[model samples]
Target: MKHNMFCFQCEQTAGCTGCTGRAGVCGKQANTANLQDALTGALIALARTIQGKQTVSAKISKQIIDGLFTTVTNVNFNDVTIQQRIDAIHRELPAGTADYDMKKVWDAQEDIRSLKSLILFGIRGMAAYAYHAMILGYTDAQLDAFFVKALCAVGEDTWGMDELLPIVLEVGEKNLACMALLDKANTETYGIPEPTTVPLTVEKGPFIVVTGHDLYDLKCLLEQTKDKGVAVYTHGEMLPAHGYPELKKYPHLKGNFGTAWQNQQKEFDNIPAPILFTTNCLMPPRPSYADRVFTTEVVSYPEMVHIDEARDFTPVIEKALELGGYAEDQPFTGINGGHTVTTGFGHGAILRAADQIVDAVKSGAIRHFFLVGGCDGARPGRNYYTEFVKQTPPDTVVLTLACGKYRFNDLDLGTIGGLPRLMDVGQCNDAYGAIQVAVALAKAFDCGVNELPLSMVLSWYEQKAVCILLTLLYLGIQNIRLGPTLPAFLSPNVLQFLVEHYHIAPISTPEEDLKAILGE
Candidate 1:
């Protein structure tokens, strides 16, 4: 039997194995899936051609990074964009070079397939980081070169677990570097994020909702609309924008408009605003608000107005003004009905109060630390994260990132040691920030990171979380509790290896897991 498409790269894969029907669980169609596969194959071909290049240039890095990132889940749904990337790779490759068949890797030995999947998906996530950094005019030659090497390794015929396992971990190593590059670029370009409280209300008047994870795109939109009588509200990963010193300086860069990306279709229904998508987590828009959607920076959808490299958001601005927004301020609340959400507790802000945090811990005022964060999904099991946060003891500090915090970001978790009990650590790319806080805590206590009073309770929905998990594993962080479900691509033996070596556990009920984590 011929399959139209086969994908299991995300947490929501059908049957927890793969999506093999007309569309994936995330709503990706068969045609889009096939096109994405072709795009990946072309990237592998380009990597094979450049396998031993003595010198790779910046142009080569950007294309490969963007292409791989485009294939990430929910990033690009436009067949035209995927085909354009594939065609560009074909033009860039040497004569007679051929694309590698992804089917070979998919149908390989179970262990081999598992290992290669890690490499491919891990790099796909890293590519998002590289792409973000590139947009800010920062590119690390070594980091860029790893994408070529890793992609080549994934396509290699002779590499088995012995060889592929090391490459899988190396994806973590390179992802760390890639994230650091992005952090530097972001902070230097937009200034370090300070702790700021973002309201859930939308102020009266014309406003555009900027979603996705691109700070540069947000910066451009803010600059273009500076005094244009239009307000800018962040959505999803863009919520951290309010903490940036440069970004928050703009009076019109107002509060966040909705919850996580998964709820956009419902939240945006006939909404009187234009939504600008700078990166991933874009759902297929409903007809009610489809005309108000505008995409930019590699995010494309059929029939949506796309803002190109010129960085002009006049079209979006005009649409927002034409909508005229609400005559009265529209008050909004988070999933918990809280009036506001707090963010910007990035490494800089967190570290500023490190002394107080340490003292609080020593005094037994703060009992534990839980990094409960990742992508939020539409699955019913996702409610466990919200409950997990709510059930976490008042003495435990919760540090969250990505869209996962939307599960409970608005909750009033109280505080300890002059720090809010729950802290927001910027976007998924800022996993590096969480790592920094972890490493610093370990050093303060003179122990390994795993020995610190910290636990990583992660919820993965897409490939970016895959790379972040690899980074955590590469750093030897252990006893991580991952849920609401495990990735279906991990063969039994591969899953056992992780379980035995790292004690990785699928999350249980909130009460049971909390007891186990706290040794109660």
Candidate 2:
């Protein structure tokens, strides 16, 4: 177990195990990973100090969130910035508190390590949601307090599975609340998303492609470049922004740029536009396009221009105008070669059609529903998602969200009754909506959600998907199918507990899985 460093927070960890060498599978160097660990330890120290306080300022809470979120996979690879955050955490800590060693958890007994990793990674994911909601002027005291409480638990030396299991499940409870706060902030600020059809063509002009999940950053960029003749295109999780009415209002907000985050290195190689990364899903830029990269908010790399709190996007705009974009409209297709893809099927849109959907279900026109979504990565076996969706019966509907949808989003699966067979359910945070719709459908059916013929076949990449899975487990929903791989952090006993209690299974082939799911 001796190594330079240890990391297994992402689905694509080296060799389906911990990345314990010079670099992680996501290109995060050992130095950066160590710094991240140090920063996380400092946050835990700060949390241990603040957990007993009656009043903690919003500023301090935000710092705790920033510290936790920076360690999430693919978020911050800038060692200097990571160190700066760690120093800030040290400055804020009271005199006697010492930084917790993260290796303690990584080196703990198997079952204890597994449960604690769930709590730590789960809150790392929750912090991203809290950060987003905070950006929109929304804050919840319970969510804020839970961050400190959970971090304190992660830092504790005496807590075993008996003490940690409740906190692990509480991460799900609080994350459910956190997602609700973010959903409110998003819907209120940007308006509820409507079904939007986004093109794959980049119009012939100066355009900037914004990736990652931060919609507020996109809003800021849209405002700053409104009359500058720069068109903005969505990439990865930002694709869901197009469904929000306030965002699509910008006339120059053009079509989508590339596919999922995994394809960026290849897809972005030759694009004649500057790309702005607002959040996660950042790959190390290639030399051909590295200079064209700009980051804002928490997403940072060494050489990229970091847009600060002032929210000015002038440098990004100038880069786009300098590139001048394509001489003619360059049409790009998704992996499936479709010329266009559509999104914006939030819970609102789906629930609005609930009566009709229920009628279709009762009448046997829609036999079942499948929710197949989560993060997408460069790892193999992802084709399982594509093939699984393709093999689903025509009588079933596929509701998807997150970047995982990009694998099959462009494929037109025709329609059941009046609704499209393939429905894009917005971004990763919109898992709240997926849960909402399921609960509503279950209520209407007079049964539990797991009894509604809905199957959750998820593909996970990082901590955000980890929290979502935790939320699903918290609700006691069973029979979820996950792939292309199970997490490396889940110990044999912990994973076995899940399989026996929740019936969670690693995905088999689409042919066999389809047969089993359909009870053929």
Candidate 3:
């Protein structure tokens, strides 16, 4: 079937196949999605051509990575902006080379299609982390080259489990490096995060809620709103901002406003504050609150206020003032009934007390470790996350990230050696933190991360989660339980490959999955 556009790359694709008609489930027009695919094809060709070149410049590499990343779901929802990226990639490549048709990969055999999808979606997700790392002045050669390698691999016709297996793990491996680079950038530019309790109450008066995964944007917003009588509250992934010393230092920076991204439609309705979305996980806006939603740095929604390069947040600030927020201080609680949440358990903070953690584990004070986290969405069965956390043994510790934790983050799970049973390791991007913690524990215990009694139970709702999953797989981490629903985009063969090789399983009932996770 001929498609004007191919959009099976996201979880919300039309009818569970490629969205070929006028628009995608994401509301992206056919022309815009086609432009994005063409841009991706051009990038793949450029990457393939540069694969063997030793002289590829950082500028070219950055453009390729950023271009692919910008095309991800809900990221670049504008046709004009996507075309600009296409033009930029075209300029980077030497003339006369034919661009690979990205649709060809999408239309390949189910198995080959699945493997390639992992590479493509994995990189798209990794690009977000790489982009964040670049903003903070961190880059790794392996990470950059992997982008080229993965893109080139997607264009290759050779398809075997061996050929595909390495690349699949490579996606995971490169993602780890990319995430590490981002972690370094974030921690150095900001600082190692410490445990911080964030309130859900929006202090009365004017305030802005910044969402998405960009710290730089949050920093910019915090800087611009300083002393403006406007309180800044975090939403979605931005909830972790409360953990950073630099960001939390702002007295006007109040607390978090909403829960996960999927709930924004109901949550943001009648909300009397402006929201600045700096990156992914943006849902289609409801008309009632659409005017109050603002986009910046590649996150675009049709008619919302778009904050441009000058980083001037004048309009967002104005909206906050105009909305005037609640009549007085309003108290909000998480889904699990807790009035507050805590975050900032980056690797540095966790490792700082490594000796204690090791001792606790050895003395049977801390038993199993469950990394329960990922992107949260509107899927009906997602409450598995809440149940997963609730079912964790009392002697176990849970590490979480992204907005998924809103399902259970509020629960008072008590503590292990002075550390809360639940540790919020920052945003989804902060999966790097969880990985770092795992690696450190492995080193301390003299075993691979896979053998460190750590099990990952992840729930993915978008491309960012895909990249993080690839990273975990690349690190040879095994037996991860992923749910609430497998990506509709993954072909059956590819799903089989993941299951056979990585032992990755889909989530079943919470009780059954919990027993299996505990090796019962």
lDDT per residue for candidate 2 within 1-520, as digits (tens), equals 3237789999999988899998888999888988898898898888887788877789889898988888899899898898888888888877777899988989999888899999999999999999999999999988888899999898888987889989988999999999999999999999999998999988898999999999999999999998899999999999999999999999999889989999999989967899999988888999999999998878899988899989888989999999999999888899999989999999999999999899999999999899999999989899999999998999999999999999999999999968999999988989999999999999999999989989999999999999999999999999999989999989999999999999999999999988888899
Q: Supply candidate 1's per-residue lDDT for 497.
A: 93
TM-score of structure candidate 1? 0.98
Runs of candidate 1 exceeding 4 Å displacement: 1-3
- The window of 10 residues in a row where model 3 has the poorest summed lDDT is 1-10
The parts of candidate 2 lying over 4 Å away from their true place are 1-3
- What TM-scores do the predictions have? 0.98, 0.98, 0.94
In model 1, state the lDDT of residue 141: 82
Candidate 1, position 369, lDDT: 98
lDDT of each: 0.91, 0.91, 0.83
Candidate 2 global TM-score: 0.98
Candidate 1 lDDT, 101-163, residue by residue in tens = 989888999999999999999999999989989988898888877898999998999988899
Q: Model 3 over residues 1-520: C-alpha lDDT tens digits?
A: 3347667776556655667788777767788788887888898888887888765689987887778778888787777777787887788778888888976887787778888887888889889888888877787777788788888888887665568768877887778777777878887888778899889987888888888888899999889888888998888888887778888888887888878887888998978988888987777888888889899877776667789868999999988889898889888989977889888887778889899999999999998999999877665788888987898889999999888888998899998988889999888888887887888899899998888888889988678888888877777778999887777767776777778888998889889987887778
